[model samples]
Each structure stands twice: as structure tokens, then as C-alpha cells.
Target: MKYNTILFDLDGTLTDSRPGITKSAVYALESFGFTDLNPDELNFFIGPPLLDTFMQHYGFKEEKAHKAIAKFRERYNVTGVFENSAYEGIHEELRKLKEAGMTLAIATSKPHDIMLRVIERYELAPFFTAVEGSKVDDTGYRKSQILKEVFEDLHTTDLSKVLMVGDRFHDIEAANDCGIDSMGVLYGYGSREELESYHATYITENVSGLAKEILTCE
Candidate 1:
């Protein structure tokens, strides 16, 4: 294999989490006396980190954005995270990659605690060797920072031998930051143009195709 470790993004990549995310976001906005965001507007929040979503999309102040995040978690923790489901054939693809002796890891912008809960809920915890999510600590919520941490955890100094896969510009940027190639998936929430704008090395129509492409890169 060309890469020793593969990093996957959680939301919009491995899982269909829009319904739960949109519901929680709406609840948060309503909690702070904001108007309900339409589906299109809510879609704008999917790929980026939650704090950035609140501040950029809703124009929330720093403190208010933090409160919105807290409110979103109130509902998300209860149901939103559990409401998620893995994409069709993803489990099978992961199994294939694992059998091929490739190390798998999750590098998501979601909070670490919540990511752990979702991973456990979906029964995907065992598939990945590492699950690195956004911490409310100094690393902030950048995808690059998350990937860097995962690479460190893997103890792999050669990032060029690691592949980053996701469904958004953030994923492409993260890979670029780490000097690695990235594969963008069309099955995710983001549009193909968005992925293209970031100049992803490979783009897949679905999970099975993604598996083929990843293996090819090796």
C-alpha cells in the first residue's frame, strides 16, 4: 500500500448526519431567539466545524456562539448523534481496507466526546485504530490540526504515506496542510464543485468506488 494510515472524516463522509444536525442547529438558533434557517442555509453548516457554523452562518458573537454550541449539544447528545447512520457499503469497504493491512483512523471536526459517542452508537468504534476529534482545547477546530494530531497518534512521521479522505474542501485543505493527497467523495453533503475547488487528488462516486481508488493510490 502507498499509505500506511488512512484518515476519514466522520460527518458527510462516512455517515448521513444531516437530519440530526439540522434539527439540533435549529433548536440552538431558536434557543437564542434567532429565526429558523432554511435547509439550504443549514447545508452551509455541514462541512465546517460547529463553532464556525454558528459565527459565520448566524453571525453570532463569540459568547453567543459558545452558548449555541452548548444548546446544540443538549439535543445532539440526547438524540442527534444517535440519529446518525453509516453510509451504505462503507462498513464493507472499511473491512476490505482493514483486511488489506491498512491502518484506519477517524479525523473529524466534531467534538471528541461526541465523536466517541457516535462511533460507539454506530458500532464503528472497533473498525478504526484511532478516533481523533476536535477538542475544546488549544488545537481549536481546524481539520488540519485534527489530522496532524491523528498522524502524531499513529506515530507516522511520513505524512506522504498517509491518505486523507472526506467530502469537503476542509478535507482537501487538511491534506494539503499535511502534504498528503486527499480523495473527495460525491456521496457526501458537499457538492462536486466544492471538492474540485480544493483540487482533490481523487473523487469517488460512492463508497465502493472510493475503496477502489484508495487501493489504487497504494
Candidate 2:
């Protein structure tokens, strides 16, 4: 492997965002009077765009999904966002990759402005070269779309020099769709079975392993 540019997924790949995302999902569902819904059950919302997740799991129409996202953001923006923490060892690995002269970037389904806030809070901005994400509405952008945006923003010239690292199928699939290689992480929201099923180019169990995979140039 000869990757020089690494595109990372935000939530599961870099940070443990389940608590805040699940809480906001619970808040949004409860606002719709789905009071019995458990926050833990909403863990699936951590990776993909909220609109797609809400629509898939809850069968919300596009309009209703938009409304649900608005409700999700109501809590997410104020409190839920702050409830997150970067995974253990994530910062150290990012620093190692930066020191190795890797061009790191973020291509996530998370909304762009909120992503900026998170990067600042976690002190991750210095490591990434660029960032691309969905709009607050999460309307038209999928992982593939935003990944392409980041790809273009970074002016990537050789597809072989890029890698997409994430924990979900959406991330791997988008990388596949974009003709880039992918590495799936198991210590995040996704399972080994899911990553393998997608045939990710590589799969690692944790942050340190992930960094080793990249830095080894193998």
C-alpha cells in the first residue's frame, strides 16, 4: 500500500459519538410521541446521515425525516455535541500520521458546521488537511458525494494514494463507489461481519492497529 492521503469518517472512526447521537435520536422520537423508543436502539444513527437513518429505521418520509433531523439538531447542537469524546488513542494516532506527512482529511455524513465545532473541541483540526460533510438538512449528500467533495477539495491526483477509513458500510461502500480503497474499524459502531461483508480492503480492530496499518505502508 502506498497511501499518502487518508480520509476518515467522523463519528465512529475518530470519536465515540453514540451517547450524544442516541440521546438526540431519543429526543427526536420522543418529540414525535414515540416515547417508548430506547436511546440504545438508536445506535444505528451514528454512522450514516440522520435523514437516511431515520427514514430507513422509522419509515419517515423525506419531509418527516427532515423534521426529525431538525428535532435531532435541537438537542444535538446545544448539548448532545458536547457529550462526545474522541476514542482513546485517537489523538495520538492522528498526531503520528501527521508527523508521518500523511495528508489526512475528514469526509463524513455529519453536518459540516457541527463537525467544525467538534474538531475545535477535540483539538483535531491541525491534523486534517480538509473537511467535507453533509448540510444541516442532510438532503442530497451521501457519503459518496461528500467523499468526492473532499477528494476534489484536496485535489487528489492519484487514486492509489488515497484511503478511506471508517466503521460503517456507508463509508466503505462510498469508497468503493468512488474507486478508492477502504479500511474498516471494528472498535467503533460497526462489526467485523459488516466490514468483511463489504469486502473492505483492510480491517483493523482498534485505533493503534489502524495507525500501524497506515504507517507501515503495507
Best by TM-score: 2
Write one digit per residue (lDDT tens) for candidate 2, span 1-218: 38899999999989998999999999999998897877787779888878788889889999999998889889999999989998889999998888878999999888899899998999888899899888764654788999889878988889888999999999999999999999999888998899999889998887875677887756
Write model 1 residue lDDT over 1-218, tens digit each, in one string: 68778899999888888888888888888888878466446866676887777888678887888888889889988988877798888888988889889999999988898788888877788889988988862124788988888978888888778889999888998899889999898888878899899989888877776666788884
lDDT of 1: 0.83
Where's the lowest-lDDT run of ten residues in candidate 2?
Answer: 133-142
Q: Which stretches of candidate 2 lie over 4 Å from their true place?
A: none
TM-score of 2: 0.96
Residue runs of model 1 more than 4 Å from their true location after superposition:
39-41, 137-140
